[model samples]
Target chain A: MRELQLSLNQTQKVRLQRALEKLESLSSKANSNASVTVADSIPVNYEDGLLKGHGTSEFNGEVVATVCGIVERVNKLVYVRALRARYKPEVGDIIVGRVIEVAPKRWRVEINYSHDAVLMLSSMNLPDGIQRRRTALDELNMRSIFEENDVICAEVRGFQHDGLHLQARSQKYGKLGRGQLLTVPPYLVKRRKQHFHHLENYGIDLIIGCNGFIWVGEHVQVTDDMVVDQVNKSEQDDAKPDENSISPEDQGKNYTRQETRENICRAANAIRVLSTLGFNITVEVITETVDLSTSINVAIHEMLGSEFYVLVAEKESVRRSMTKKK
Target chain B: MEYVSPEGLRLDGRRPMEMRQIRAEIGVVAKAAGSALFEMGNTKVIAAVYGPREVQNRSQQLNDSALVRCEYTMANFSTGDRMRKPKGDRRSTEISLVIRQTMEACIMTHLMPRSQIDIFVQVLQADGGTRSACINAASLALADAGIPMRDLVTSCSAGYLNSTPLLDLNYIEDSAGGADVTLGILPKLDKVTLLQMDAKLSVETFENVMQLAIEGCKAVATYIREVLLENTKQLEYRRGI
Candidate 1:
């Protein structure tokens, strides 16, 4: 039996096993024997002028798999879809990364790819939301926007000779703060049409980076800062409080509400449970898991408990089987 | 002292040509890109592959191929006598180099340019043939990591003891001052990537010993393939449609 890190009681274990078995049954059988280990021969019709793709190579005049994955065929092309591998980035993928280095005119972001992606200051909209050329002074003040260890979200611009380049040209793609970042296997995060979700009901935001770095945080209105500045100036006439009267912490006046904070933690723990169960992390799946926990009155921390894992597993199995029936 | 008994069995009640039972488990290390634990009898090795990611040292970055790095360590309690061996000991360093070269031969480094792959293998239990066990574990981990390779590399150690070619030698036979031949091969390609021997053997006897080791390696390769296939299937189904 495959080991689940969580310790489960006898009944929980049985439930989990049954749910997993149901999932296995629900999956299609077309590619049942298409799984290949290292160096195993992938059956193909050589008469079709085959083109070998990634995770495969020519060995002894035979197309053999070089990785443990499922064989995927499309007309004359064949490739292996590897599981449990590092993130392979494609252009225009929304990814969350952590700033590792504040270099000259560029920031090196670790996006779980083969190399640290380079985010040039010129490529992103500055805090002022202006389209001016980046000056030497702007380079000097790069840390003001993204310094070392700051978590950021951006789009994959493209690959270059130096390394991968990222662009943050939109208001929503910039520094992410006051959030919990969860790292899961990249393969589990499928590239979908929408990676950013604003959970309106909970007043929380979920950013599912294609690189498998997920961010769950309080929702921030994605408005141009320049507009906000004008609004703040007009509101200043309404008798603003004196800055010196309050402590530095209170002066910022950016404390998150208790309800929103709880929602963030709840969403983060929901993601953790989905990752532990090795299920695909999507907005629908995550919201479903969160609702499941809330309906059962599972605490945020207790969502990782053994019984909760079993329940999630069972729920997922039932959900998948229902889809299969349709 | 005779290694083979009068009934043609070895010390541990196994035939001369028999191999130890093999067991493998994948996804043992959660943080690693790929990981596996392999056991050949009492020799247990856990391997974790961290990259095909950004190179840690910029100076060592290769332009055309990914840099391959390997580290081999054994726990103090793995041996009969608990000895605190410092890091980079001569024996471990040599073994690490051997494993790296063997793995590099099979890995398609050109596909991952400007990156580095790290393989770390630790011996938890050492009955004998830790080298072979470590190689098998690394192969499984690399495959699990989805690093492209020319073929899966499998290794085994055989010895010529009491004029018999013993497959999968035990610690007793290994330390008996007989010839120990460690062989690594690409089963599908029928090519040898690593061959090392300690002590001397006659040409005829060495041929027989090498052949026996090759057979053991092929057997290990088959088992490894089965384990990897099963793991891939499980991961696919678990991820759902």
Candidate 2:
């Protein structure tokens, strides 16, 4: 007949009525201590014999939440009584959050999970191109692509000892450039993550978060429409090359894989910027191995090989205008 | 004199001894094992029941029974002044104990020995009669959990103010009362499993107030019993071949 064996057992329940009768005699003597002053909280009779051995106990049968009563936050630290548990985060949860900081090559997203998510520029794949490096010019335009407060789509790339990394490499990811950013209570946001709206149509892409920072925006790219065309085409292909189709040089062991991946990485970040910026141009930066920097002119001219040719022509025109004085 | 002045009326303008409007629904939280929402006047309570899970502590594992636990919390804005923290309070703790104490008498604990059952009640608002509302709400949650119970437990506070005895006391009357009595009853058995009274009253008046409180609880139990019965009927209908 026994179901839950808490403090009020059969004896207790039956005894409660009798206890009340007895307690009546002591009522005048008992004091609620209304005159107590404010102070820090102190634990009172929260733990009975049952919950006392929690940390040391190896048994799974011990009921964790068996407390029936506790002290209130009284004048002086309410003699405390605790039985509740704390909440912790898990993996693969979608949370919405906001951008709080714009760091070099990374954005700090406050996802309300007590931790910031790093949306690194490297997470995004550059548009498909022969140019494998970003020049100085690209760095100047980087902030323009993802400003301090701009929201963006990203995936939980991986968590390292450093922090949680979010990536915008996929077509589904990147600068959620404009929108009314709504901040919701963290818990409500957690509850809403499971029922988030699909952004594919609003051309909206969401970060669906665990920390809560979210990005929503339409697509744009800075590279020429041709490069944008190639990036879109390459992404749509989603092609995984056959191992058999691998080049003989790459097939060999110790093929210096690390350097190639890093080289391609630079190009990838550049593509992320250009493709999102509405550039349809194909890669001309392949010839000169320029690195991305804060300077946009050097970045654009060096990466777009054709741009260098345009620069040369413009320089010759300037020279003719200067020598015509002779 | 009225428990509430005849001219002043109860906060909602009901006569003394009148219970506040109670709106209850079950199975509201999708993720909880069992959930129910009970709104007594404006004292809204949400309860979730989880149980029969493996008990993890070594010493608490009794060779013979499941454990019952209850946590009662009021949301910060539920009252006139905001509460900085939500959990771990004395009045809340006392209320929690009573809820646990009352529920233990009804649940069939032997069915799952060495296990535990948890009842978490969150008060979203307060006007008065919080304990009874929590009890009523927890009962629905337990029932929604498909747990076995001896009977539904309903609680309500009855008090005496001025000369009139009130059946359900709101915050104002309760604070201003000469005596406040809260009782939880097992309606079918006409048993009082949990009872607490503050302040004082004469013997005859105390008896009358207790009777009125029990009667109010019985009425609430009857209404909630019907709700559980209808719910079971619907569930059975869904599973019918």
Candidate 3:
């Protein structure tokens, strides 16, 4: 066998690490540890507060910038580290916002921090899958699509003189009709991804707002199949209910295990898209997740067989489906 | 310049083996990925915890385990004579190394490699025993950050002066010219993680001073524990769960 390299036990490693930390610190003050910027820095500054800085330029966060020099309304960069910030959108950043106005052709969303998020009219259900200018028919269906006083999850499209554009093109990202909103110091949320499985395990949904507010909740129940099934199971336990003997309610309860599984699978899918896009229990963005998922009174073994979350279909028209009545 | 009095009492009117007040607050830096601040007498320190994020520094990443990085910095305003550089100096480097080693014993680093957990300790003020205070602060901050650790690391320093051993030496005792020993211990495990001495003491007297320092550390741990509990309760209560 080849000779193995000497390995460090825990104690030795600790000692080594300490020495290294000293070295790293020395290097850093010497301006050598040239990395550590935000996007991931504590995260709170970007998450909640409306960003205010010198004109048009977005604070570049690709690397952490030290105060090389300081003055009112502006600062100078002396040394730059990695993990810097840049303008234009990166994927997976939460933006807080509300609906400003709507038309058959398009709906405009107001993102608090960077720029307004726009929902183009033609983006919905087009053959080419590309939205163009709005039409009269879209005008008629506009309110049917969206109205005032609606808060939503939208992806940042791009930047323009008009402002930052937004799209709620996916079924997962849409109008949050119901749920309480929760706010926290943004950095904690960033650090949370450390475990990488908290969202998946907990079976929750989340919507991160760039303005630092969060919308979170369990999924909304689409149908009461579990409730209906439970009643049927209990009836069966009491007596053998033949087709004729069973009531109308009992008859509707007969969802095959596969069909029942499909329904739950759909909800779980919805939870994933929401959670994956940076939504978690940190917000009051609840809908049907809790009611339907919790309504799943199935046995533990059966639950295990089911997927953790039923992902929602990613689509631009998804948010348009939510009506004012909700 | 007497730290231990003729009556066997220390400068603060206690016995020669006495510790100054120790106070701590854990998880205080909400913006930091994790943090805690500890105060030993007039020596106050703020320790911030960050990372386990995307790993940078190719040469630094390890295949088998995570690396612990500590930076012990002194604020410009901390000492009677201002420090021009808060970090990146020999003295700070040595202290930082000691803290990192002492803390690593308790941390479960293999859980997160390629990622870094940066513990930065800034001494806001120094009355005495800055190193011991820094170690205690880092430990609480690590625990507050929810980092896995075997036990809390607590430290205290003792010195022999005028025939009596003193616990928790203040600046006066430390600079007064005597034998000084600082010990970092995992109180529950009864393990000594870091030990260093700067002056000399007789064999029997050294033992006495060491024992006094260990006791002082035990007391500091109690104070740290209370502060941590109070801080956790405050955070939990704010969450209103």
Ranking by DockQ: 1, 3, 2
Per-candidate interface DockQ score: 0.74, 0.01, 0.02
Question: How does model 2 fare in lDDT?
Answer: 0.56
Residue range A121-226, candidate 2, lDDT tens digits:
5555544423345555555556765666556555566677656777655544455543334332122123333423333222332333434233332223335544
lDDT at A26, model 1: 79
Pick the winner on lDDT between candidates 2 and 3: 3
DockQ for candidate 1, please give it.
Answer: 0.74
Of 1 and 3, which scores higher on DockQ? 1
RMSD to the true structure for each prediction, in A, is 2.0, 26.2, 21.2
Write the number of the candidate with greater TM-score, choosing between 2 and 3. 3
What is the per-residue lDDT of model 1 for residues A102-211, given as tens digits with 9 covering 90 to 100? Answer: 98999999999988899999999998888899999999999899989999999999988877999999999999988799998788899989999999988999999999
Give the interface RMSD of candidate 3: 20.5
lDDT for A26 (candidate 2): 32
- Order of models, best lDDT first: 1, 3, 2
Q: Quote the positional error of residue A203 for candidate 3 in Å.
A: 26
Stretches of candidate 2 off by over 4 Å are A1-326, B1-3, B6-11
* Model 2 residue B10 lDDT score: 62
